[model samples]
Target: MVKRSRRFVAFFLAALALVLALAFVAADRWSRITARDNAELAAQSVARANQGLLVSELQKFRLLPLVLAEFPDVAEVLADANPEATAHLNAQLELLAGRTDAAVIYLIGRDGVTRAASNWRLRTSFVGQNYGFRPYFRGAMRDGASELFALGTVSGRPGLYLARRIDQNGRALGTIVVKVEFDRLEKAWGVDGGIGLVTDPHGVVLVTSRPAWRFKTTEPLSRRALEDAVRTLQFGPSPPARAPLSLSGSEASVGAGRRQEPYVAGTLPAPIDDGRLTALVPLQPFLEDARRVALLWGLAILLVAGAIVAVLLRQWDRQRMLLQSRAALSLEVERQTAELRDTNARLLVESQEREEATNKYVAAREDLARANRLGTLGQITAGVAHEINQPVAAIRTFAENSTKLITRSRPEDAQLNLGRIIALTERIASITSELRSFTRRKTPVPVQATLGSIVDGALLLLGAKASSQIEIAVSRADREHVLVGDRVRLEQVLINLLRNALDAVGKRPGAIQLTASAQGDRMTIRIVDRGPGIDPAIRERLFTPFETAKSGGLGLGLAIARDIAREFDGDLWLDPMEGPGAAFIVSLRIAR
Candidate 1:
């Protein structure tokens, strides 16, 4: 029966470990999925922001030709259609080219002759070219403004051409064409680790961030991805109920429309002045980050599992050794019982020792319970202190200002101070409300707040009782540094530690320095005191509940402060610096 019980216990422990291992794996997978989804959402947001910038840029291009056509000299030259007038027009065109990113600005006469041009000295090839039949010029004559069209070449550059017909007394005279470099447009679209494409409604690529990829056959993977996205988009704006279909034989998770997930593709309707822009961001890069997290989680779980197995095996071996000792002791006990039958008096002393051992065990259990209770109280006190500090500080500041005004005999200043004092009193009342709620053991709500404010609040709560001889200095290295945390809880930790430091210093000219600074992904706050430093004998037991160095004092302050730090996924530890002062450090993870 004993062997069977041991076997059952061993199997049970193994089964428990296996269950825990599986849970760890599931948790890691869920985390990866969540991370991937968030990355995709970020990518989509970036794409939308880029689209807005591109549309604004396109509108600027559309306006450039209209702006240039209004120049009086150009208008006058086009109306006269004379050689000397054309020379004045040419000079204005040169100024336009030098001032803007426009490649060339020129006038195309009704008779299909390039009468005047800018950079014509550089490119005489375009001189007198018959461009009267060009769609951009014809469109400007027909429509009020020129429609954007792909210009094949004046210099072998495919660009958007904007033209405006020169009219005098309601008679069409000629056309003014402005060629905007498409290469610049392409550069603007290419951002955020992805390519953007502007295509006409007919699917012909008008411009692309990647010119080399233009008109190239889509890869099988990309072709299927594009087709699936188009189909998903066809279904309209509703999000897919489940994961959209992935590209065939690929691990990539594809979605049809814009999504908050790790991968997104969508056709954004460009402004009416420009063609539609299709934005596609590959999720594979973002998934790599998720995969890395998963790998780390797996490694951590494996380490924990291995440790559990080692502990269980050691326990089993120890139990076996204990059982062997018990068997040998039983045999010896039988022999002793026979001998004790002849000397029963000696057995009483042995029984007394057994009773003493049992008493020791009971005392140990009582001590453990006392420690637990003290730890719980310490946490409660720290939280209370943190919550009460904010308003107390505000009230103190206002009261001090009011006192100064009244003493100065300035009636107007005193009146203004009285209003501020009232405002501060109301603030104190609100803080009291929060304190009442916090002490009721409510869950903490995290918010973005400055470290400076938290420190001030803590100092305020301590008030004058914090020891007049103790000079407390709170300094922030960078004022703009912000952290996301439960403000009340953080203040509680700070105030408790500060109060302890003040007590440590006692009625002497001791300095307590509270310093806060940020170091990438973490914020470190150091509380240093120049009091009688921690006694070497009790330094290790400083955080142990109910173990105080000071007479008649409960040693729960440091314990409670540590608990609050851990609650925020941070840590509090004693600094190992050797000096005449004691320092305690609290480190918290900063929000990225």
Candidate 2:
């Protein structure tokens, strides 16, 4: 039963675990999908916002170059006809460049020669330098306006060159150039965990949030593009690194860093421009977010599952307990019902037994009364003969002795002898009277009697048959030991025991010892015989009717004796010991 219960519990737990695991898995997948979408949106927003800043910054200075192209110091520097106007124009350009945050303001002739510049006074000035091969100069001569990023030939610093053609008389005279550097913009864009970088049409990073990434190409450069970059020296001679990210899909890109950290990128195109602005944000936040969501939701789902399982298990257990309790109650009721039936059967059996015992008692009483009368008459007859023989022999001896004294002329002696004869007759009469009374079947009448007196009377009756052949002696304390019982019945029991003792000692050297003692409410009378002990084989039924050891015995002696002893509310049993001879012990209630 216990094993089955445990198996049930184990199965329940396994089922609960399976349910909880499924719940956790489902919740984790859902959370992961939601988190991924959120990450994509977040990355795209960063990319677009950074892109707006880049475009706005570029627009802020876009008009400056176009406006500067219309300025005319009479075009005197380009013609070389007014040195005063050129110097004054140089000073004014310097002041304008400072105010507008441009790197340099310069003018070039139609031959692409640096005619006047804001840094004309400096050692590395663009003044008097020829930039006819530069793309911005070449493009400005052909087109009305041009914009290009290149390295300055005189200063060797990288900047975006915006140029416009100065046209007069249906021909281009010189170009007005404006150099834009975004040192402050780079600092603002690259700080505070947000980044933005512009990639050229050829996929090179022109400016970036991180300085280390500037001038890096987004894709592998071919031999031609490398050669072009080397020849121009626009970004120095260093081999540019590939951009950290590659386009992944519509809105996201896969990015790798120096240590190969995972990143997600969002790309945007510059409006009315030729570059791409991209924002690279680390994917760690998205991953962490997804992981946290998975973990928390998984735990919550499992907790709810466990709680529900607990409630179900508890409810199941309660039902099981109720069922078991009903079974136990049923068993208890059955057991009690069985006991009640058994008790009723026992009472019926006892009633039948009681009725049978009553019938047996009535029949036994009538038989006992008749048996006692017959037994009294028989023992009385034997006792009378035994008593009459002893006194008759003594009378004869005294008669002969008196006759001898009379013959010797002793008259006084003769008178004394006659008196003894009369006394002997009186004694004989007393013996006869006692026998008559003893032989009558009277109701058992208890009187105070000594143990010794009872034993002596029984011995005298047995005296007719070689009474001196076996010895009999009583202890002094037992001779006067008092008790209450019918003297005749006790005497009868004693006489039977002594007869058996004498017959056992026939023709052998033996002795009889009688003992008396008291225990609790009873007095014990033990008759011990030192003759051939009672036969062992018949000892078990020694007191049963007609069971005896003697050759002609009726075996009624012990049976009758034991019954008479118990008639006084006492019992008898043979001594259960290693006896030298037979020993019978009887107990009688002691008188108060």
Measured over all alpha carbons after superposition, the RMSD of each candidate to the real structure, in angstroms, is 25.5, 32.9
The TM-score leader among the candidates is 2
lDDT of each: 0.65, 0.74
Ten contiguous residues minimizing lDDT sum, candidate 2 = 249-258
Model 2: residues with Cα > 4 Å off, grouped in runs: 1-9, 19-32, 154-156, 244-246, 250-258, 271-273, 320-592
| Whole-structure CA lDDT of model 2 | 0.74
Best by lDDT: 2
What digit string (tens of lDDT, one per residue) describes model 2 on residues 1-592? Answer: 5457667778888987787678777766776566667766776898777777767777867787678766778266676648898888899888888888889988999987887888888888888888887778878889888888765666766678888888887878888888887677777776757566777787788777777777888788888878878876766767677766565553344346555554556777864238877776766677678878788877787788778667765766777788889989999999999999999999999999999999788557535533643564464466567668777888888889888988999889878878888887887886666566555556667756788778766655555454555455557865776766788778777777776776777645447776777777677888888778977899889988888778876777788788878878888788865756788888988777
lDDT tens string, model 1, 1-592? 4576568667977787788788777866776676657655764565577678766766776777777667776667666667777777778788877887677888877776777888767745455888775667777878856755453445655566778887777888788887776676577667566656655544445567766544322222245534543443321232112223232221233344665333345456665335566565666666577767777877787798678767765776777789889989999999998897867766687788889988887565435434533443353454445545755676677678778878888778767767876776676675555444334433456656677767655654555345344454545454445666777667777767776787777646547777777788788888888877888998888888777887766776677678768867899998977778789999987765
All candidates' TM-scores?
A: 0.44, 0.50
CA shift at 490, candidate 2, in angstroms? 99
